[model samples]
Target chain A: MKKSSLILASAGALLLMAGVYLAFFVAPDAVVRIDDRELVRYSQKIFYFHVPVAETSFVFLLLGGLFGAMYLGTRKRSYEQMSYAAVEVGFIFVLLVMITGVLWTRADWGVWWEWEPRLTTFLVLTLMYSGYFVLRSSVQEESAKARFGAIFSIIAAVNVPLTFVAGRLDSLKPVHPTVFTLQGASMEGPMLAAFLVSMFGMLLFATSLYIMRLDLLRAREDIEYLKEELEVG
Target chain B: MAAGKQVFAIVKKDVLAELRTKEMVIAMLLFVILAMVVFSQAFGVILNDLDRVGGGLLWVAFLFMSMLGLNRSFVHEKDEGCLEGLLMSPIDRPLIFFGKMLGNLLFLSIVELFAVPIFFVLFRLELGASMAGIFLATIFLSNVGIASVGTLLSTISINTKTRDLMLPILFLPVIIPLLIAAVSATGGIMSGEELTEVYRSMRFIAVYDIIFLLVAYALYDYVISE
Candidate 1:
């Protein structure tokens, strides 16, 4: 890694460690209602990291779309790399969010999964990006692959809101709790501080990971180009 | 010829070709009926739950059947290098996209028309005379939405190595919203619910159709590139 990237990555690592410390050690536990007659004592700690990671995944995917459009317009290989990198980082963050989300859901709701709007929307988004990777792998020619990937990212970006609406509409039909009990409820001072710290830390971690992925892709492309050149020479 | 005329000319040519072969619709109908049979057999014991399951089955059948047509829609062009010819033609790319999309929509609608009635008969369910109009409207809106997106994706995926398999993987997720609305509206009508209750999903379908149609129309140019 380059000097700047190494510094950034280590800084991100340090911040995330600190943030986790804050989340577990400093944050207070709170009681939440799961059903009409039941209450569960839950640690509100996960929300700080979970919400940021989830929201950051959206940002990374959006960047994927934006860079994808740029690649489509310019036909530049670098933009394609950026788009792919953004999606790779976003996909990891999304997986983390899902793991954390499911754990938190199980803790609070006593069930592992619910067809809630946000959860369903994220699931579809993950599927779409997985499809994006599948598309990327299927095409042989480099330029065609880039163009197809770019087109897919753009399409997936558009599908996100539609998926949200559809998921929300489905949620309205079933009589389950549409809202996660802890979400949007106010937090205490230490809880708010920890949430903010973790949120910033997660975003930094996501961006640093994106940079690392981009650098790795670039190096791979360079090595491949050199190999081909050697064969031709 | 003008672009609009060229679009129709391609549509007409495709329709005439389909009329001659009768293969696309036949395959689509056969696939759909097969799916219906499988679903009925699988859900055989639970006759009471057909009302809930039938609408979802209907949309899945439509979606898979449409895939058959969409896959076939590009074969002739790909086989004889007619896609190259079209690209070399004076007409614009979006026009060609519109032509093929319209052709796919027509064939898909025909398959739906055939499959829906057979599905009702095989499953022993009814859309009711009053609910039939709303169900058809939902079908229409969702078909256009799927057709538009499917056309663009099929064109892109056909060039890939796994031509046939890639289309569905890329297609199903994109059309989730349309499927959501269509299945909900169909389910509502089947359950003897008021039209007012289902109108929201219908509106969602209509909006999905319009927005995706526009997106596909614009993006089709990039998708068909050599």
Candidate 2:
């Protein structure tokens, strides 16, 4: 497990660095028409990383919920640990999405925040997952904590799509950048390549982090077990 | 038949218990009405116009008040060893969830039945009879979402160390989607928005309610089991 994570980490880092280079050099700058004048958006480059990170965050959150439901059914300790770890990793990417999203919005929209649909939904997503950790810590009994965490994760996951759709209400409006329409990828060739590379890189990197966190959690439990044995002996 | 009977028995027990104390219902009523008072005073300048944002105010008050009632619903069971008695009974675990959730729903509805009129009267917001019916229906739909999710979460929260404090943290986030839909539905009505828009929001609320109800039904067994 350790060796694989190290390998995955290096491969992911390499791909991510390549992705950055391609994004900066290969991808054309996005041009927006304001009053019929086309102005190149230098900040549009953040879209590559921002979008990949955002989508990756959704995948991790879905995995967290999947593992959570699995744990409930099987009553397995490892599945619960994976669920917890996935949520933790997913949360970090969500924060990154928010940061990059904010910077991009500031540059493009000229506002620090707008109650746009995707933005509002992501905000709700962040708050919902944050509650998962708080719920975990507040439970004293270990098994009960796992049980409750799993339950909340399942529900929170189910909410992701609902919040997203509700976010598109007429009042919230549709201000988020649209790239992948039903017509398909709205990007040129090199740009799509950069996006795909960054996306796979981000997924691999996140997977490694999840494995490392799971290993650490298991180690902590082992240490606890040893300490109890030592005290008894 | 047996499951229905068992669920009814649990609901009856909670209703009987509440009747004896009349504590939660009265407090919930007072809390909601007082919340409107606070909103009236705090948003004094804006109090004159409750058209655009009145739905949001009603929900803010209702959400907190619902949390208060939800927290209390489970505290007594855990404190008085009633939970053990229920567990010891031959009823299935999911039936217990339905029972407790229905009781919570009943109380929440009763509170809103009174609070909604007081909200309208106090705020002096007027709506036609037909509009009022839709408004009440929207609130009822949202109440189902709240009571179901609340019952499931309150059970989890009450078992934690910081039981009361834990609920809003857990409950509020999960309830945000419902809040959005409910507020939009009610706000649409208050602001004279299109009926189609209000119905769309109501439909989403119903969807949210049904999904959570299914999730709770599937998960409640693990939640209550020792």
Candidate 3:
């Protein structure tokens, strides 16, 4: 990583650690009442990390789509690299969201998975972006690969939100389908502070990673260009 | 000639080709019917209360069968250099997309028309006469969404190396939302549920179709161009 990205990444790591400390040590435990019993819900702690990660993934994917459209409109190589890097970073976050989401569900709901609206939407989003990589690999031509990838990214971005909306429809007859209760509903001052810290940290960390990946992609292209120049000379 | 005329000419050519060969529709019909039979044997017992779940089987069969047809739709154009010819012609790229989409929509509807009746008979279910129009409307709207998105994606997939295998990978995920809405609507209609709920799903399918159609329209030129 370059100096700027390294610094950003370090700051992000520090804030995230602080967020963790605040979340566990400072924030009051979430209490759930079962009939007459008050019980501390430990799994609620995961909310600080899980929600921020999920939101960060969505932002990156949305940026992936926006950058893709920009690349398509301009046919600029820099835009294409930015688009690809965004999707790649966004894809990592998407998987992290999936894993954390599953663990959270299992911990809180005592089930491995639920076909709830939010989960179902995220599942489809995962599948769609997975298709994006498959699509990028299937084409051999360079410009065509970039073009197709950009197009699919834009489609997937648009389609992900639509999938979320569609999930809310009673069409899947979701066993009285309701979205999983977002656990952040009970946040107090400490919890809020921790969440904000984590959210900013996650965003900065993701941006740093995106920049690093973008630089790597551009460097790879440059090396290829240099090799071609030597071969021609 | 007018854009409408050009589009119709493209559609007409596909119709004539299909009429002459009877290949795409016949194979689709065969695949669809066989899939229903497979469903019966696979889920042989306790399928009696299949009204609600029947939507799942029906869509899986149609979605796959549509992919088969969609791949075939573009294979001929690409194999015979017809896509190049289409590009070289005077018609607009978006017009070409609409033309091909209409052709696909027609074929999918026809196959479903035959297959759905056979599905009802084999499964021993009656949609009752009154709800037939609504059921068909749901199927038709779903088909429109399928054809629009399928046509656009199929155009892209055919250009890639893994021509035959690529369409399903790209198309299925993109179409899942529409599929969910379709299943909800059809299931609602079959279970003799509220008309209002069924209409909502149908409206969703319609919105999906319009959104994809507009997307394809704006993007097809870039897709088909070099």
Candidate 4:
């Protein structure tokens, strides 16, 4: 397992390096409108790393929900740990999404923040997931913490779609430019390659981080269990 | 006969206790009235346009009032450790959820009933084109959503170190969709817009209420037992 993880880690790094090169020098800059004026933009470059990482983060969020449901079903501590790790990794990626989204919004909309659907929903998602961590930390008992956290995760998962739907229906903001639909131009070969590489790199990164965190949590739990055993003896 | 008596006993105990102390009602009412006063001060300069902000203020008041009431509802159980006894009872955990949610809904409705009149008098704004029945329906449905979700959350928060503070932290984000729906519905009524325009929001609230109520009911056993 260690050998496999090391391989995955190195592959993730290598793919990321390749993606960076492709994004910077290989892919063409797609034209975009800024403030009703057409601008040839280079930060369209951010999309390669940005969209893939954002997509990966959402995948982790759903994985967290899946593990949460599993934990509830099996009453296993390991599943809870995996769910917690996924949420942590998911949060880091969510931060990246927000940062990259801000840059893109500024480049395209000429505004730092817009209460648009995607951005607003992402903000709410970030908040909802952060509350998950808060809920876990606020409780002291291990069983209670696990139970509450699992329930909350499932509830948050259920709400995520409702939130998206609500935002879509309620948002008065106009839909902005999207990469897939810009002038009916599809992603060229190099751009598609870079996007896929970045996505694979992100998936690998998330996997390693999840395993590392899970190991650390298990170690901590083991030590706590030993202490309890010692005191009982 | 025995089951009916026990359920009534639980309900009567809660109601009698509430009547005697009036802590939950008074605290929630005072908090909401204070909020309204603050709103009046904040919007004093816009008195001419008070109608525009009136709907928002009404919902804001309800939101904060619900928060306060939710926090208070569990205080007695936590203070006296009576919640442990309740959990040990043969009655199902979901019943506790329903009992508490119904109690909260009753208190919240009472507060809203008083608040609407006070709000109208303070703002001196007519109901305009709002159908009174629609407005009442909005209040009824909104309270169910709040109480259902709030009951479970308050239970979760009671076990936390922050207890009261954690309730809103854990609750507000989950409840935002409901709030948006409510505000839009109220806004539709206030703006003299067609009810059809607010149907989407109302439907969303109904869906939210059903989903959360079911989830909370299913999960309440795990929550109280552990």
Candidate 4 C-alpha lDDT tens digits along A1-233: 46666777888889999999988888777777889998788767878888888888888888888888888888989999988888888889999999999988898678989987778778888898889999999999989889888888888877777777777666355475566664753676888888888889989977887777788889999999999999999
Q: Estimate each model's TM-score.
A: 0.93, 0.97, 0.96, 0.91
Model 3 has a DockQ score of 0.78
CA deviation > 4 Å runs, candidate 1: A33-40, A171-185, A225-233
Q: Which pairs clash in the backbone of model 2?
A: none
Docking class of 1: medium
Model 3: residues >4 Å from true position, as ranges? A171-186
> After superposition, which runs of candidate 4 have C-alpha atoms over 4 Å from their true positions?
A33-38, A174-189, A229-233, B1-9, B128-130
lDDT against true structure, model 3: 0.89
Chain A TM-scores for all candidates read 0.87, 0.95, 0.93, 0.90
lDDT by residue (B1-226, candidate 1, tens digit) is 8878999988898999889999888999999999888877777877678887678888887888888888888877898898998899888778988898998889888888888888888877765676788788888888899899999999888989899789988998898878887888888888877777589888998888888888888778888884
TM-score leaderboard ranking: 2, 3, 1, 4
What local lDDT score does residue B58 receive in model 4, on the 0 to 100 scale? 87
Per-candidate Cα lDDT values, in order, are 0.83, 0.92, 0.89, 0.82
Q: Which has the higher DockQ value, candidate number 3 or candidate number 4?
A: 3
Report the lDDT tens digits of candidate 3 across residue range A160-196: 8788878888744454222235763444588788889
- Candidate 1's displacement at residue A206, Å, is 1.2
Interface RMSD of each: 1.0, 1.1, 0.9, 1.0
Of the two candidates 2 and 4, the one with more favorable DockQ, higher being better, is 2
Alpha-carbon RMSD, each predicted model: 2.7, 1.4, 2.2, 2.9
User: Residues B1-226, candidate 4, lDDT per residue (tens digit)?
Assistant: 3555555666676788899998888888888889989988887887667655677788888988898888887888889987888888876666777777777888899988888878888778667444767887888898998998898989899889989989888888888778777887877777777778778788888898999999887777778876
Model 2 lDDT per residue over A1-233, tens place: 69989988888989999999999998888788999999998988999899999998999999999999999999999999999999999999999999999999998889989988898888888898998988898888899989999999999999899888888764877978799999999887999999999999999999899889999999999999999999999
DockQ, all models? 0.75, 0.76, 0.78, 0.67
Collision pairs in model 3: none
| lDDT at residue B104 of model 4 (Cα atoms) | 81
